[model samples]
Target: MTRVLVTGAKGQLGSDLKELSVHLQNIKFTFIDIDELDITSTEAISDFFSGQVFDYLINSAAYTAVDKAESDKETAFQVNAEAINSLISVIRKSQTKFIHISTDYVFSGDHNIPYTEDFQVNPQSTYGKSKLKGEEYVLQYENGMIIRTAWLYSSYGQNFVKSILKKGREKEELKVVNDQLGSPTYSGHLAKAILDIINKDMDNSIPFKPEIFHFTNAGVCSWFDFALKIKELAYLPCRILPVSTEQYPLPAKRPAYSVLSKEKIISKYKINIPDWKTGLKDCLGKLGELR
Candidate 1:
């Protein structure tokens, strides 16, 4: 059996992975959140790894409060960057494959085209910078694999989809920013992709390679487009208006164009990616909000 350790078991991606794990074969998952293990403490990680050995460690824990990270930079780096260093220090001797989840915020989002893996990263927010630091630590590890994703949402947690669903039903009109463009990733789909990679590696269908990869649902749209689609799908009779980013000022600056290119992961893993709309529909169905 393949022993896999998944951190951030309470988050959307981790939860999705746990739910999906039940249907798979020859894999035993040990899910832990901060309550079970404090990743920020190097001694804590060392002690945890003392008795247990895992074939793979899937790190999904992160400081994802984008606007809040502007003021709480220390906590953000501690969780996002320092914790990764701690994990690497302990896992180095065990030779465990480390799969870390990252965000599209690592880019400046100034381009008109999709972001490739090798594009020069220029993060514009505190959250992005901190995540980038974590990526640096992971890159230094010979066994590390970084999967950068964007606009993640799921049925299990608080996300844009749930937020829009709630407000769209209660409010008569809504205004969303039209300038920011990116792809929406359903955490369920991402969870499946992760498991697919792990299974392929274990079965020798495709050997595991330590490299950065991008994963997201196909197609791109702005926040306004996203909200409009949500309203349409939920059958909410609300007027949705599109506004510029300037109209809605946020504490943390978001990438205007952070759509990640899926060519590398798709071709290398031979995984079929669903369109964003399809993902959204499935997610809504899971939430029992699909009309």
Candidate 2:
């Protein structure tokens, strides 16, 4: 059996991975949140890896407070950048195949075309910079693969989808920025993609390559388009007012156009990426089940 260690087990993506692991007959998963493992401490990671070995390490843990990262630089860097070094050390020692999750924020959003993996990264925010640093650290290990996604949401965590549903149910009107462009990635889809890669590796169908890849739902849309779809899917009678980024200012600057190119990942893995509308519908349906 393939022994896998997933960090940030309670996170949206990590939770989805754990949920799917039940049906993976050939894989044995060990899930751990920060409470069970402090990834910032090298000693802790070294001690933990010394006891047991894992075939793969999926690092879904991250400091995702985008707006708060501006003021909380220390915590963000600790978790996003510095802590990654600790994981890298342990991954090297155990010869584990490392899979790290990154963000589309690494781009400056200055391009009119979709951002590709080889695009020059110029992150505009502290969060983006920190995540880029973490990507750099993981890339040092040739066995590690970095997957960058955008606008992630899931039933297990608080995200834009749930927030829109909640506010759409309570408020009569909601204003969403129309200038920001990206794709909404369902955590469940991403989790399945990750597992698919591991499965192929296990069967020797494809050799695991240490490279950066972009994984998001098929199409792109602005925040306004996303909100309208959310309200329609949830059957909520709420007016979604489209607004510009200038009208609503945030503490952290966001990418105006961060649509990632899926050409590379699609050709390499032969994965079928779902459309944004389809992904949203599936996520909302799962959310309804819980309520």
Candidate 3:
């Protein structure tokens, strides 16, 4: 059996992985959140890994409070960057394949085209910088792999979809920034993709390689487009208005064009990625809000 350790078990991606694991055969998962392990402390990780061995470690834990990260940079770096450093140091001796989830924020929103894996990154936000640092740390491990994703949401947690639904129901109109553009990825789909890679590796269909890959739902849309779709799918009577990013100032700078190129992951893993609309509909159905 393939023993997999998934951190951030309570997070959106981690929770989705846990739900999907039930039907998976020949794999045993050990899911743990911050309560179960303090990844920031090197000693804690060393002690935790000393007792058990895992074939894989999927790290879905992160500090994702984008706006709050502007002020709480210390906590963000500690959780996002320092924690990976500790994990890599402790797992250096183990043969565990480390799969770490990263964000699209690592790139500056200055491009008009989809960012390839080798795109020169210039993160504009503190959160992005910290995540990039974590990516650097993961690169030190020979068996480490990084999967950078964008605009992640799920039925299990608070996300843009749920937020828009709530605000749409309570307000007559909602203003969403139209300037920012990226793919809206459903956590469930990402979880399945991760598992597919692992299963293929186990079966020797696709050998595991330490490299960065991008995964997001197909197509691109702005925040306004996302909100409009959410309102339409949920049967909410709210007017969704498009506004410029300048009009809706946020503490953290979002990528104007962070649409990641999925060509590498798609061709390499042969993973079928659904369109963003389909993913949104699935998520709404799971939330019991789909019309």
Question: How well does each candidate superpose onto the true structure, as a TM-score?
Answer: 0.99, 0.98, 0.99
Higher-ranked by TM-score: 2 or 3: 3
Cα lDDT tens digits, model 1, 1-291, are 889999999999999999999998799999999998999988889889998999999999999999999999999999999999999989999899999999899999999999999999999999999999999999999999999999999999899999999898898999999999999999999999999999999999998888999999999999999999999999988899999989999999999998999999999999999999999999999999999
In TM-score terms, candidate 1 sits at 0.99
Q: Kindly report which residue stretches of model 2 are placed more than 4 angstroms away from their true locations once superposed.
A: 289-291
lDDT of 3 by residue, 80-162 (tens): 99999889877777868999999899999889999999999899999999999999999989999999999999998899998
> Could you tell me which residue pairs clash in candidate 2?
none
Note the residue pairs that clash in candidate 1: none
- Is 1 or 2 the stronger prediction by TM-score? 1
The Cα error of candidate 3 at residue 260, in Å, is 0.3
Query: What lDDT, from 0 to 1, does candidate 3 have?
Result: 0.94
Query: Sorted on TM-score, highest at the top, how do the candidates line up?
Result: 1, 3, 2
Off by over 4 Å in 1: none
Residue 97 of model 1: what lDDT? Answer: 97
lDDT of each: 0.95, 0.92, 0.94
